[model samples]
Target: MKYLLVQEDEEGVERLWGRCAGVEGLFVDPVPPPRETLTLRGCSPEGPLSEILAEPGVSFRGLGDMCVEVWDEEEPVQWWTLVDAVVVAHQPHPGDPARYDVVIGAGVRNEESFFDVPATPRFELLAGTTVAAARAGRCSSVDGLFAPRADPDPVPLELIGCEATEPLLVGTQRPRRWAGAWADLLVLDRHGAVMASCSVDLAVSEARPSVLGYGLEDITLTDGGTDRPSPAARGIWTEWYQGPPAAPNGWAPYDAQGRTAWLELTTRAWRGRASGPDRTGGAYHLDGRFVTDVPGLHCAIAEALLGPGRYFGREWNAFKDCLSGGFGVAPPFTLTWHESDVARDALADVVEDPEGQLSYFEETVQLLERCGVTVVLR
Candidate 1:
């Protein structure tokens, strides 16, 4: 999909810098937890296993290949325990060609080591084999295998398949200054509604003239600690961006993270639309049927106060900020929480937070009462 890179001026107006035909490094998997060594004692050599054992210094380096499958009653139970790397130091059991002790080296086992296995697990080798060269349409791997380990320090976002709309050599050259480099990457759908967004410091680190005018190889990302949407969430966004829902509460079917992402997009769309008298004494109706989680509560409350596709807050701290003023309402307002029983049953248990441990539903009600909000439960 094409990505439009735009910079916002002091007045908050967006200016187009360039467009990218394709982007890299936008969707990244979370760094896998480090692996430890394990010993598979008395593993019998059977069928193809004997052939694999015959190879000297046998290793399983393919993605997800170096793993011990856990089974509980003839059915596989746990399979995600992956080995980042493995080297087999095979030692045959004397006089028993059927029995073999498999010594797996460092970074080869996960939380459930061989000691935790209840049954002899099958070793899978079906994980796709690695390639020596990068796949087509993408640049070669920097470290010879896979994209360079996500830099410990923030790496610049890569914009591949880039093309300049105008002559890059003749247009006003953007200086490499932080003041001039700050920009936002706004991902918009066909109808121009923002689906996802993140701010970046856009100083170009590398570029080259290509058949498509110019290619921007590297652009610095400066929004520290901001989480990118997961690949699944992006799929939902792909459709929502093209055509938003006709009414409110369209985010009901999503998982917790996806629901949170929907709130983010809706919040952006709601900006500059809030208008009303001081909301100190106004009453709002909260449809509490969907208030099953922290994010879900925010979604319900935001829609209650302002219409659909609005934002009251994201988290506890942000909620407090919204209660102060200008989030389409002020405190000392009345909130009629319909179907409050659903939330009570859902969020009855306390969960840990930076502030303190408290049930989300309980804390929300308490916080509202403390802030001069009269809550009516029904």
Candidate 2:
């Protein structure tokens, strides 16, 4: 099936954002139809299994995986749970060549965000998920699209029509900033092509507003506590998440404690001679080169790909150069930032000057693309 995410206005000039492929590696409880029984049935009392077996509805969950079995189906059925699961898809049925049949799935899990406040949280997928797919592209690993996690069953799904020229309404979402709230606008083409991507942020630096060009050396982030402006004049947050640095459970809150400074800003990019977004124009190629999740792997990837050229440690230019294929053996190569970054945006700016790193990344990514190398970091 093919899918696309787009942002269109009355002007009819649309933007292409990203694609979704059904390969997010998650097992979800598939909600059965209204009249159909989605839960497991025919339970008998065993000493310890009695309570579990007696429940009218059954959905089992675990640390990472979840599962459910239904023997009463037209055919026996099994389901697992997905996080931020695929909600809808356009599936092409066998013998049907001209039109696409939408393949939809039920959201089997019912877990609320530990925090009820909307859009402040993030998620992790065992395997990264693409919310939309390209034309004629295979939807791998994950099969059917799902409803929202909060809803156990599917709701009315409004999607763009299946025409490449039709503009669709992709969502307006926020990218995780190092601290506080910020968001970006993403626009995509009907066939899952990226048109234009942009964001709006506080743009503060050295007590001066980057966007408005005003200075606020005195104002700070204080929550009933005294403000302590620092090196760059931004105050350390007090009562950031309604409490101390850590939650009552003793775990560090995601937005607190300067943790975002250390977050790896991952990106997916290709740097090669003559390689197109379609992956054409070269015999020499390297693909799916994952920089493993291990201590110092960043340095390791830099050392391997850039040789003696510095990718990290020292300064920002070194990091940009290494990623842009300055030190790569390079004919053409596509590089991805692995899986974890998907849980949170890899581009939570940490540099006191937010765009210091942002602009360089943008510049380098565009330079690489113009040079026939494609880099993707969403």
Candidate 3:
């Protein structure tokens, strides 16, 4: 006779079977059915063991001598029987911190059948079943892992798809003067990008009350505290400078200690070539002590002259011409700076006014000119 083998746990719940007929209304029980027991009895006229084997839906789960068959219906259709200690389900509990729970039952093909059943005991059984399955390298479905809820406050912008953009070019030009000090001005194409780009390194000694102006309307002052004002000024820089015809009068900031030391501001500028045939168009203008303060400043000015990105181009050739040579080939001369008006204070020699007091400031300017850095003092 064809046998229907059913394996039930200690809780008397049906478990799922793999690759079986999807028949409806199949019955299960913790013990063998009466029809199977009677069949077993008729098969074994002499012994109970033979009789039990005739019973359907019966199984044994232990080694020899300890194994107790509930009933024997054609030897349980297949001999070896196993009962997992744990079971798991993908369905999550309502408002439960634990993502899922352990279920105890015969594994089913479709979980929808269990929806109407009570959840408390089922969840407890699921939690235990999960632990058992984990040892065997089996996992439950990941659906319904977490309930819908608002995330905690202060989420990172990047995490929410708000990525940062690159720094944009506004407008570039020669340096200008503000309140007796020369200032390099650039109109930022986009204020948001500029605010993210500009940075300042305020050395300990250089720390003092300072203010940076944004366009003509806003100004931020720093009273030598931890907070700096570069971010805000950059924002304005990006907003005001958009396209080709950059605003004539861009933003400007002044150094409070103007005469004591020359300030070097490095910013990206625009690229443009001269219009005429003379083609000797690589020339940029600089006003005041910035050119005379450092030798690197000469290189920077030369780089600025040959358009924006042509730093090591024809301007470098002009700079090479300034070196003394014996008509054909000569060793590269090492350019060095001695004590100048800006750098006179070797030890506490802070005169504060290099333009009025030191003649070396003028000499420094001439030396920079020889190095191909043109300085127009006003």
**Candidate No. with top TM-score:** 1
lDDT by residue for model 3 (66-112), tens: 01111122221111112321122122334452332223222122111
Task: For candidate 2, write residues 349-373 as lDDT tens digits.
Answer: 2111211333222443455466555
lDDT of 1: 0.56
Regarding lDDT, does 1 or 2 come out ahead? 1
lDDT order, best first, reads: 1, 2, 3
- Which parts of model 3 are misplaced by more than 4 Å? 1-236, 239-266, 269-364, 372-378
Question: Higher TM-score: candidate 1 or 3?
Answer: 1
Which candidate achieves the best lDDT against the true structure?
1
> Which ranges of candidate 2 are over 4 A from the true structure?
1-81, 84-145, 148-198, 201-299, 307-327, 331-378
Error of 3 at 341 (Å): 14
- How high is each candidate's TM-score? 0.56, 0.21, 0.21
- RMSD to the native, candidate 3? 37.6
Lowest summed lDDT across 10 adjacent residues in model 1 is found at 131-140
